[model samples]
Target: MTPMNPDADAVERAVARLTAALDEGRPVAPVRDLIGEHDLAAAYAVQRELTRRRLAGGAVVTGRKIGLTSPAVQRQLGVDQPDFGVLFADMDVSAEAEVPSWRLLQPKAEAEIAFVLKEDLADGDLDAARVRSAVDYAVAALEIVDSRIADWDIRLTDTVADNASSGLYVLAERRLGLDEFEPRETTMRMYADDVPVSEGAGSACLGDPLNALAWLARTALEFGDPLRAGQVVLSGALGPMVPAPPGTRIRAEISSLGEVTATFSEKSGKPEKRDA
Candidate 1:
């Protein structure tokens, strides 16, 4: 185990507060005032601690998700680069499953490409080509992001500490080999219900989703965690995220990839009794 940082107590407190908010299914005020200002390193430290706690609680780490890679998203968040969050097995909502809106604080949906790696990518000097070589295949994905910060008011540090505002993800079953589709050229059309909400090309994600993946590969290693084989990596958003409300069915079709769907509904107290 690595030595705990001097601000370990603060990190722990932040983790506790955020975890409680998540556990109780409620939003909390941003922790910036509580943890001090613009401490990116400390924010990441809090994230690491939070991940440790979640892992201890039987949450299996399945993959990672990159955020704020698109120019529009970056501009919206006022960030220059991308942020990432750890993905756990429990976070994987099946494409056919109906998500419970009440379980999430403030949910929104973004279309993305998910890369499944066949080999470990640990090099800090990784480039897009090297990144592509490690990818086994790519699938269409929908990232349902929820922020714990009240009213979605957050800064870079606030979000990093809040696990990149990750909530749930649904991945399409179809897999396309790297050669089968160009990540930069692929286009995505997102729909809320049957109406189009947003559309964008893969290039919108830092010129290419692979580029964002490369950035994540390098960044993860710097944080002492490396991207390993068999882990899915969400390569950021291809378009603007649409508000995901209860009873709304969302879908995204990626050119040459396939379509993925997510439906949000109110959670029921009990399973409906079905007729024989």
Candidate 2:
């Protein structure tokens, strides 16, 4: 499932090649060997490649995304640890922004709470209170996750090598102060086109979403880039996964954080017909 290689440019080149292929909507294999050989870094290599190209194109990293933090998701990946990704300026969407559906590849919108840090927390006795104390606030968000890799057929190494399949993300406007609600006790309901798609609680996210933030801080430091003040951290998914279709609206209501919505613009195609 993995191969080791040692080319200094292997990771960067592999990322460029893969991003090019994906941008063209062409299929290609995961750059697992490139990651294994250049540096045994799967997640870091993925983000490095994404940012490498994104920066060349003049995009900036606005935040970070933590994936596979759920025990169930970890089990699915056959790994015990989670992975993370960088959030680009392109991924940020205000509450009412229209998200073009064609921009994503197999996108799944997730319901979760996002934390914006006021002070840097780089691994210490970082308790939930300290996590809360270093706060900006919380926002109800929808992460539009799309894998650049084909068929989403990937192993832990394969996915981690693809920026944790981090394609696009969108955020809502409303922000509640740290004292506004309990992060762990909050409950979330996901709606796709007004239908109840899934339901979950904040506890589902690594016991508490803040813990997810903590992990992101620690793990990203391990990956070479530590969390910095004013960095926005998406805690992870709290509800079930659903396919995001064109013209569909994704609404997520967190019991504590209020509701946030993301509208998906229909992909260009034939319009639906009216009944005769």
Candidate 3:
């Protein structure tokens, strides 16, 4: 699909708009107006430009994130493939720290499995075996997704250009080897303030979390930035995402992978207490 606006100019406009929203801590209109709703190529162009700007600003690439792994969401977006976003070092917030609410707009939380690579996927068939073998370990993680678009109103292109609506991520401490557990068979249940909020199985993520990794390795290779050794890969959500408003405590337990938690700080940066 051709962008509603032209190529380079449209990408520049999209980058500028998203950058402003991030810098000012406010959401803007959907960028689909500039880039077409279905022009994934144009959408990714905007993403690359934004990544470039972040790099110029001293940000370092930490890893990558796979989004739209749910088949239902993919069908809704009219795409057969999942989209990805670059993860930066600043996005990591371990469970020990409170996630500052001031750092996000329209934040939501989802449980996922995160893989740390032990080999480069730059040259290979990039099949399931290769990607799975490259994993050094897997851990439970919480992805705090946020949108730069106002009210979280976004289409495929809009979200893609906004770095797949990335915000902060919290990782659990336990590490399990592939032989220690089966990803597709794992079950996940997320809680907000000790109340169960969302639940699903590992199969929710592209049939298996490893499948998501394989797809990302192949796509990242095709895009000229293959998954490298030591990079962390968030293999998409294991369940439906739930809104994470300020002063909320989120905890996700994934069988075999253990649990991860994050408490969203109030605007004042004070940690919120869990419900009694």
TM-score of each: 0.92, 0.86, 0.94
Relative to the true structure, how large is the alpha-carbon lDDT of every model?
0.85, 0.74, 0.89
Q: Write the per-residue lDDT of candidate 2 for residues 207-239, one digit (tens) a residue.
A: 988888877776666655778788888889997
- Say which prediction, candidate 1 or candidate 3, comes out ahead on TM-score: 3
Superior candidate under lDDT, 1 versus 2: 1
Q: Report residue 153 deviation for candidate 1 (angstroms).
A: 1.1
TM-score result, candidate 1: 0.92
Candidate order by decreasing lDDT: 3, 1, 2
Give lDDT tens digits, candidate 3, residues 33-118.
99889888889999988888778778889899999999988888778878889898878889346998877879999999999999
Error of 2 at 230 (Å): 2.3
- Top candidate, metric lDDT: 3
Pairs of colliding residues, candidate 3: none
